[model samples]
Target: MAFWRSTSLFSSSTPSTTTINDNTINQETIERLCDRLQLATRIEDRRDALRDLKGYSKKCKLEVGTKSMILLADILQGDRTDLDLIQLALETLSNIMTYEVDNNDEQPNLPQDITIQFTELFIKNKEHVHAALDLIEETDFNIRRTSIKFLTILLTNCTKTLQDIILESGPMGVSKLVDLLQDEREVIRNDALLLLQILTRSNANIQKIVAFENGFERLFEILISEGGSDGGVIVEDCLSVLLNLLKNNPSNQSYFRESSFIRRLVDCFALNSIGEKHWLKQKETNINLFLQVIRILVSPTNSNQNIVACQRSISQCGKKKIES
Candidate 1:
């Protein structure tokens, strides 16, 4: 028996019932499967079907290639779909991309084609941004988290469209991205930070958005308030964003200098006597960032008192060069 026949069909116990084959999964069957996936009461069932479809893609089962890609793209384009399903679709697509990379396969790069289609869909569909925002607020933390990851991937791959979406979404979208900094999941937080970092780099207008929104303050708060957490991933991410923002807007160096952000970063170095685990590793990052911020502040062009304060803070923190 073929792989699709072995895995795609479900045998019914009733003698009158029949197993459905891959060939039978025509356009209508694809539509019905998509409908069931969208409306399924049980997450497990949806997940199982998602897994099967992803597996089918991996095995180069092109029988349902166009249909599966279209269905998955539809899910990606849906108005109020379950975030878990969205994430599953995204991950499945990502896995397909990875398989394509590893196997040097070119035929079933349907996901990439779908990505282009979804880029257009997201651009033309007014509901796209709202759906993404809703997914960010999903009750399931993992779903919420993965959606951000997918969004970042989408944004990275489809920069022009994502930038347009961000511009249209405006301060509200910026605020939503800021709120994710406090998310319990570090990956989501990091991705949000990264998006902000990317957006700030895209245009000087975004600098005004960041400054007007007190974005600098929020970044500092995350670094100072949460740096001591489990692995300091939050602190590292926050610091990276801060560094990028500062690099982009040299004027904002004053904000970091005045807001006690420098001191807090220095404190990370001072307090991180712990051995080299995740948190300590992150501590080293904070220290390096602290030094870089100091370097920026103390440049002859920026001879503010804040520069002196930063030097003093680093001195007090003790000299510890970040290992390359």
Candidate 2:
């Protein structure tokens, strides 16, 4: 989420800014904010502290590192009625959890030690992960969306640990994520695709659960809805998730074949034009991912019948894309 602020140079009655916006925030300020977050009796004070912390986190990664994760998680797990507070905490946690280490000279990237510490602290307690999953059940799209972003960061930093927790949360955890695929908001839907793709990359259990949750079917439905190859990066993102599911897992591969998704897969290859200019990088990438899915299904490891069936599906395809 992009942060936007409006400033009035002539106004004198504005609220005092706790976090210095220009320079890297100091550890003293972070500790003060965490103290407020931990001890604040009223929801308004907690929100004020979290708002300042969220602002500080965007610029000073190490100062804010892992200091308030426990406090934030407490708010998430304990507070149900304050949607604004939950959203602020999630956003602040996301900023603190950001793992990308930029080499920019203006602001030094977080050291390796801090990054590992952040990941370990969050995963050490299973409730933190559970609290994150619970926030998604909230009806507010902003909270749900921020929760997804926080989970994405967590999953990226600690893939193995987070994957285990998510799987242990039962089918409900992964199911809620799959439901995001059908979100009426495109941004939410796209973020869910990326999250599921990362979540299912190496975990066969998650891949199976997602596949059972109609992962393949919904992905194909989204593909058609986005205009197949005529769509943008979303088309490639959808194929990437499909490829992960079908890649090495025999069960998912068999599911793809049995579900008659092979017909749908081949239909995506029918582009408006095959000429060089017509094939934008994104379309070519989508088509390339499509071939990968097909290859996985028809690999020698799969049954000979499955290979023949997939081959037949492709051979029978015409120029026109299949209607969903």
Using lDDT as the measure, the top candidate is 2
Which ranges of candidate 2 are over 4 A from the true structure?
A: 1-25, 99-109, 275-277, 316-324
lDDT of 1 by residue, 161-234 (tens): 66667767767776667677777766666778877766666465556567557777777666656743333666
Question: What is the TM-score of each predicted model, taking all chains together?
Answer: 0.61, 0.84
Residue by residue across 55-168, what tens digits does model 2's lDDT show?
A: 877566655654677787788888878999989888877777664456342135334455556767877889889998988877788998899988998888889899999988
Native RMSD of candidate 1 (Å): 9.4
Can you tell me which runs of candidate 1 are displaced by over 4 Å? 1-51, 57-87, 93-130, 185-187, 194-202, 207-214, 221-234, 271-285, 299-324
Relative to the true structure, how large is the alpha-carbon lDDT of every model?
Answer: 0.59, 0.78
Residue-pair clashes per candidate, as listed?
A: 0, 0
